[model samples]
Target: MFLFIGLVLFGADRLLLLLESRGHVNWRRTGRRDLSAEPTARLDSLLEDPDRRPVRRP
Candidate 1:
């Protein structure tokens, strides 16, 4: 029973991570944006490049 419970928890964790990757959830702590800080050079370049706009999902 304990093994089954552990498996279920593991599966749930994986599902949450998958959702986060697909922009359906916000559970991860890595690479979070700091809105108050100045934009980095890499970000600025990406923004200025008209051919590199991020695709929006429907």
Candidate 2:
């Protein structure tokens, strides 16, 4: 009936949103690169150098 049809549509919409949030694709593929290594090096350098100070913005 109408109630069943409404529930089906709602469920479908929720499922689509869940998949999209998890980066699931229906057609195209997409992703981001890992910058973990670069950040670790920069952080180590900053921690080692106690004399250096952060630059102030104008």
**Could you give the C-alpha RMSD of every candidate to the true structure, in order shown?**
11.2, 7.5
Report the Cα lDDT for residue 9, model 1: 93
lDDT of each residue in 6-53, candidate 1, tens digit only: 999999999999998888877764476687696656767656876677
lDDT of each: 0.81, 0.69
Please provide, for model 2 over 1-58, each residue's C-alpha lDDT reduced to its tens digit, 9 standing for 90 to 100: 9999999989987787778678784422334546674545566875776457776779
Against the hidden reference, what TM-scores do the models get? 0.48, 0.42
Q: How many angstroms is residue 39 displaced in model 2 relative to the true structure, after the best TM-score fit?
A: 29
lDDT (C-alpha) at residue 20 in model 1: 89
- Candidate 2 TM-score, C-alpha based: 0.42
Error of 1 at 33 (Å): 7.6
The residue pairs that clash in candidate 2, if any, are: none
Worst 10 residues of 2 by lDDT: 25-34
